[model samples]
Target: MRISTFLNVHLVSDSTGETLNAVLRAVAPLFEGVTPLEHSYYLVRSRRQLDRVLAEIESFPGVVLFTIAAHDLRDVLVDHCKRLGIPALPLLDQVLTMWEHHLKMRAGEKTGSKQALDENYFRRIDALNYTMAHDDGQMVHEFNQAEVVLVGVSRTSKTPTSIYLANRGIRTGNFPLVPKAPIPQALLELNKPLVVGLRVSPDRLIAIRRNRLLSLNADATSEYVDEDAVREEITDANRLFERQNWPVIDVTRRSIEETSAAILNLLADRNAK
Candidate 1:
């Protein structure tokens, strides 16, 4: 097997690692192919915690990215990484230096400041709650309350995509289009929700379902992975979407981000009209 190449990055922080995580997510995608295996050491405010984390870094040597506000802890991590022959970066160090030099102001060096308890945070929490509760058409009665509704066949990335949208403060609900099952009645009554459908090719559907079955050690006797059955399901779903006049996204070759972008475009177009 060709093992996937990945970067072993240690994210050290004095508080919650949310800012560091967001930075990594935004920057890592710029580099193609290789993924990051993150080793997060959060709330390391003392030399004692640093001692344990430094030992772990030595055992599994990798580049380290830290958001430590303490000078001694940062120095310890940097010196340890230097001795181990690896790169260590302090995120926002240069920016903080620039502000101190030019603006003549010293930062508070506080942690979790970006995640203040405010209206925006509350909106995200509410969206997350709504998304989780309405997953897989659980709360069908709340269909009219959703900002967006995603309907797709099993394993078509519905749940993950819906959760990602929720993180963006969008109230999303996803429903599965099981073979031979009727569409939900509440779905037809969605007036304000921007309902969208996801479709995939039969071959890809069969491959995904087969791998899913193998992962679960499931019986292959089920029609879930049958190519003909999947094709029929896709056809029926396409027909249903057409009758309902909802936007459709073909996710056979699209990633979750691309699919979400397309949905956003469709929503923007709908709003424009």
Candidate 2:
């Protein structure tokens, strides 16, 4: 007597629920008009840990999608779902099984093998460190060494986009466009790196700066949050972008990925030409 338009899904993972969520993102769009209500359980490695999730699954029985690599724990989850008359699918099992057969080798004896401490992880760490060192134009001497430079006024999504680029192996540096501060000569002198400017709407910048000040428990009555001053700031930044002939991205409504994609496209075009 159970009928539903939406599917209840439990995403269980050993480490962060990133893997299972990513897989679901790829597959869920195929079934149109079907909404998935996801209950994500991360770091579920023990029976006691899974007991709460199992209780929830029994109440609204539906599909269980997981990326659990621990064999015994995986079996326990599958068996419990079976008893509830709920179907279970381990997203990584088929892919890993095929790799095991192809490579003529058994997989490692650990869950979350993809998150192993290795060379690629170290590279990411190094990139993170480099991003931190060069953030907010602190290390101007290293500006020439960057793969990409993000220049923008406050709350233009400069720092987050720079870090995102860094995580993708691009050594990114971001400098804030202060109202009257001098632009870095090193940035203008850089010959090989891509320089991208980020801009946001004055209203959006005002709202963002207001919230930021509130978060810091500081007064929000400064010129930083004034709409007119913010509008002038944006105008000046745009003028700088035009003066330098740097590609500009409007981050008012764009996600970090979208902004970065546009910057990446610019880099590709500049390199190609």
Candidate 3:
């Protein structure tokens, strides 16, 4: 039987006011094929909005998963969903239960590690903002602080990977590989951090390039996105990375999170050196 699911995550945050975005980011992989009918707002700052949201839930069809944390609000949301005859799943109910169980089973899951991770996360955010603000997407730097440097063609998931790495407490820098363009002289001398060059299959890169050009209302098919040219560029990039003894990862099937996790694992291994 084909299964269809709909999710309506109602996030509640008292201080940070970022619970919704956090939940969405966490659950992004789950909504790949599901259609998003609508998104409703019911901020805690506005009690009136909460009432309206409760009323609106009555008209909502099918299953709607809510991600609320406020006690009274959670009760109200569950009641409203039941009144509408819709299935609702609470956000942190079973998740925290399982997490607690896992934590109890693990060895040396100390508070110190958690605190260190939190501190590292904020530092990563600062670095990311700096990178974005200073980025021309072409300029190169010393990148001495980078734990791992990502090299890929345009839109080959370099920037997102860098951001993901940063979030995982790995300072990541990225450079684009343009065909026949000179790489920064400084980059050639880097012998410290592991450099991972990302490669996508030529056909996939062509499709991505085609969609990008069409979105910008530019030529849908050009030498820039030519399959042969992209293939050659990937080959050359791989050769360069090989010549420099940098590791290469074909990112054709990996998500940004997976790529970042792999990089972190590499760093962890290196630190044991």
Candidate 4:
């Protein structure tokens, strides 16, 4: 049997703590048999807030990652961690220092710069709104307004992938490809948006559909979860995708992030052409 180890990880930030959480997620999977228990402290700007965070750090006594713009607060946090014999790391200092060196200028001492209410922030919000409005083949007539359109049968992760792309300010819309149903004419006539098809292995699709039915307490013995029927459904979807000449992504072994990245790369390639 494999052994498992649980580690306490403290993330302290003067902002929303998004960066620290992202970094922790990216690095935690690199180690086998180790699971990180996250202790997040956001908006740690004041000394009192730092004191509380430091107290928690002392209590847990684990790895600490911080992204504090103020030098004084950072110094206090680091010094406290040192006293407790805990490893402390500044997540953004190295990148900021490198940029400062390259530009021959000091980095600004501002907290939550990444979460600023800038044009890009508003654009992301707008994209999210658009994505929610156009989800599941809704607003088909406005497909022309989307940057990316995802088409896939049920349980292929079209909605989540569309939302993920929208979070990055790419206006995304997804439509479900129903078996024995005609493809929407609006989807076929789309000229602006880059339409991509998401597909999965027959076995994976069946498993997912089974779980979905179990969750809803619905009948699980229908054609939806039938092995042969699922295979035919996937085959039909693949044929439709091929006939439309749309790019297809096999999502059997791909995460939503990975699928979104592939879609973005496809969009980039299309723009380049």
In terms of TM-score, the best-performing candidate is: 4
TM-score of 2: 0.74
For candidate 2, write residues 1-273 as lDDT tens digits. Answer: 545479888999888887788878878888877788988999888889988889989887889998787788888888998888899998877888999999999977576555756677777777788888999988877877788889999788888998888877778889998888888788777766788889788888898899999999998889899888888998998998998998888999999988988888888887798
User: Candidate 4 regions off by >4 Å?
Assistant: none
- Can you list the residue pairs that collide in candidate 4? none
C-alpha TM-scores of all predictions: 0.74, 0.74, 0.68, 0.94
What would you estimate as the lDDT of candidate 2? 0.85
Q: Could you give candidate 4's per-residue lDDT for residues 105-144 as a string of tens digits?
A: 9987867855667799899999999999999999989999
The local distance difference test score of model 1 is 0.87
lDDT of each: 0.87, 0.85, 0.68, 0.91
Clashes of 1: 0
- The candidate maximizing lDDT is 4
Backbone clashes per model, in order? 0, 0, 0, 0
Q: What shift in Å separates residue 142 of candidate 1 from its native position after superposition?
A: 0.4
Residue 103 Cα positional deviation in candidate 3, in Å, after optimal superposition: 7.8
Model 1, 140-214: lDDT tens per residue?
888888889999889999999998888878899999988778777888778999999998888998999899999
Task: Indicate the residue-level lDDT of 168 in model 4.
Answer: 92
As for candidate 1, its clashing pairs are none
User: How far is 255's C-alpha from truth in model 1 (Å)?
Assistant: 3.1
> Which regions of candidate 3 are displaced past 4 Å?
1-38, 45-47, 61-64, 80-86, 97-121, 133-139, 164-170, 210-231, 253-258, 268-273
Q: Where is model 4 poorest over a 10-residue stretch in terms of lDDT? A: 108-117
